[model samples]
Target: MRPLDPDDPRSVETAGRAYRVLARIGSGGMGVVYLGRSAGGRAVAIKMVHPEFAADPEFRDRFAREAGLARTVGGGFTAAVIDADPEAEIPWLVTEYLPSVSVRDAVHSSGPLAADAVWDLAAGIAEALVSIHGEGVVHRDLNPANVLLTADGPRVIDFGIARAIEASSVSRPGARAGAAGFMSPEQAAGDAVGTAGDVFSFGSTLVFAATGREPFGEGPWHVRMRRVQSEAPDLDGVEGDLRALIESCMERDPERRPTAAELAERLTGRAGASAEGAGAAGEGGMASLPPAVTAEIARRRTAAENPPVPRPRLEPPAPLAPLPSSPQPWPAGPGRYAPHSTMDPAQARRPRTPLIAAAAFVALLITIGIPGGLWFTVRDTGGGVEAAPSAGPTPTASAAPASPSPTGIRGELTFTIEGSGRVSSLTYMFNGKTTKLTKVRLPWEKTLQIPSWPPRIPWKLSYTCPPGGSSDSVAVDGNVIIRGQGSSGTNMRSEGVL
Candidate 1:
């Protein structure tokens, strides 16, 4: 068994019942997910919300309502909710554990799925959505991360952002819900959404599985949002029946898009058939996945059954015999150590050699106007004095100006927002131009590389949250700084020099 992380909770309880947390498996903007075991020995995935959000009444209410809806969903293509405590000091929900990799990871590691495999994936996800929507819950965030590819099929998980059909807002005002590339146009626009939104997201996910790229081309969050809203998806490499089905689901008009039930029927060749017939047809879909997928699933199961043994680490070789202590005298020079023969044995034994060397080093630094606290080696090159390079603070005048390298910014720009209020947008002004970041989630911290530009460029950052709450703006002066304030009047700041 793998050792537990230091930060993993030893145990957690709800309603006075305890669960031994084994390890952390995942984390997101809202909470951390832990692998845990109940007293009954059943394993579960426990999602614990950040403590800061637990105090927000709105968040608690939403959490409770969603967890209740999630309990109503039942199917082979989805993980079942086991327990939840939305009122707990740290709100948490537990679901049956499914040991599987996400479709995202699968595609990243093994490339895009074959046409048959993509069809199987679509059918499984559509069935999951049918069950989820049948329970009157809309999974607002149905992206790749929320879909788990198991031996049985792809099991839809993570209904944390789900809400009832009648609920007006999935998130606070001005804050859009769902992931950027997977969101439907309506979702990106912050408009009322329903089961259709999930269909659009499902279509996008299929495109990703088939082509290993988001339907919308990559860029900043806002750019992806624009493409989702206005531009046709770049389905260049996708073709055949799979292409037609994905295109139907991705129709711009929500009314024109196929429902999850309809999608399952069409993909399984049971279109215009009765519900029972469609169910029977869909049952055979998983058996049709590409041989590669089946092989991968079997390989994974076998590996799980028998974990690899860790190899023992070889001990490092013993340090070479201490070089024979040679009685070498310091080279004679004006600013160098004198010959040992010139010093008495008593003086050398007095431990004054370091003191004398230090004094001479200090004098040399003063003479050369070198910065203090810097270590330098002075050498006589037979004719002139030479100094070894010093690993210290750069000199003000001679130092090269820090700038974004050809590859990109030398470092990353991080934004961390705390408290109950959500961030609606983040704007960065650089070189007389402004880029607005609208895809950020509330109570989220993200680090992204800045676009390449000249060194010492002046920049500014501004963000918007709930109105009437005090928020701060920070100026970017070629140095890293974390600046933001919470809705509850909590101040936050951090700095890192590149």
Candidate 2:
């Protein structure tokens, strides 16, 4: 498992209960999602509202009441809502946690999905929309990032931004309310967006799945928003029946587009998740995907279920005579450096004090500034984009237990939040431990440190900053680095393996 990022919460309370924040999952314009577990060990995804949004009187009032309506949306393709507290100081909702990949990340990593896979994706999303719309909820933000691909099918998440039909129709003033390229023409014109807007956005998402490019073509979001307002989508790669269905959904006039139910039946020969023949073209619960993507998803599932816990840092072995000109590789698991077990037979039997000290020295060197060595490496992915989580073995629940004591050294760990030229107080936590800092200044972070090489028990963190344009990120043990910038506002997150 990865350590939580700075400003990440270690645990949160709701419904008169506390949920341990396992790790921060992803951050969006509306809120941040964290991998959490109930006291009884039930895994859930706890979504906490962004400070700025929670402070908005209009949005908060709507979120406090209508957000609960999301609970009414139940289907095979949507994550089940467990609990929610819209009335809380910072509204939060909880859902069953599922290890899955977003359509955006998948396409970016593996290229455009196969044609058959794209159709399956469509049927699943359409079915989910049927469930959502049936409950009178309009998913105003149906971008590719909100659709998660699971073993069963594609599941649409993050309805926290959606409002009930009986509620407000127009989006919050000055806010886009949806992804720029995917928003409908009415939405671009700042008009009331109904369920048809969701249909339009669905079409754009499909276009992206079929071709690894934006639906309205590439440029700044404003340029794309303008294209969405008046220009035809560059559907160069989409073909045949799929193309027809996409074009129908993307029609400029909302009245011209098929309702989600109609779309679902047309694609899957079924109108809802419970109906028979739910998947398209004889595929079962899942759409047929490329073997590579399928394998990666399975690997991710295994890893999530059997996450690795931090252990007491291992000490360097006592040094002995060094003479071997060449060394053979030793088998090990995932990490910055492999298990260093190979040693001269004579040296292996010697006392270990000196070796431990030497190893510590090397590990410290690597942690502070050196690129690579025997242990940890300080990874700062400063380019605003975070690298994908490194793939590794899926450790089991009954795997190695943590050492009883901590033998590692603590070093200064700094945290900084880039805001709209205003200092914002923040909160951060780890391993179910927490602290709140108020009126703190930004720039270089305060002191934090690490001593031992590979920590066994991983720490989790959370950050809550008042809205506006700001960036929040943390590099823990150099394993995970997350940054949220640009249109996503002050909230940022990225996932990486420990």
Question: Which parts of model 2 are misplaced by more than 4 Å?
Answer: 160-172, 270-283, 308-498
TM-score of each: 0.60, 0.59
Residues 1-498, model 2: lDDT tens digits: 244543456787875788887765555444567788899998888988655555556666687666678888888777878888766776788888877788887888889987767877888888889999999888887888789877667889866455421132222223345566778898777688889999999999999999998888864344566798989998998888889999999999999999999998797653223234333423454555666667877876676566545333434333323312232344454664565555668956877664455456534443332222222322323211221222433222222223333354533233345444434445565434456766665443533564333332233334444445544433332111233333322333322212
Please list the residue runs of candidate 1 whose C-alpha ends up more than 4 Å from where it truly belongs after superposition.
1-3, 160-172, 269-498
The TM-score of candidate 1 is 0.60
Q: What does candidate 1's lDDT look like per residue over 332-356, in tens digits?
A: 6667876543645875567556445
Candidate 2 total steric clashes: 29
- Spell out the clash pairs found in candidate 1: none
Residue 29 of model 1, lDDT score = 45
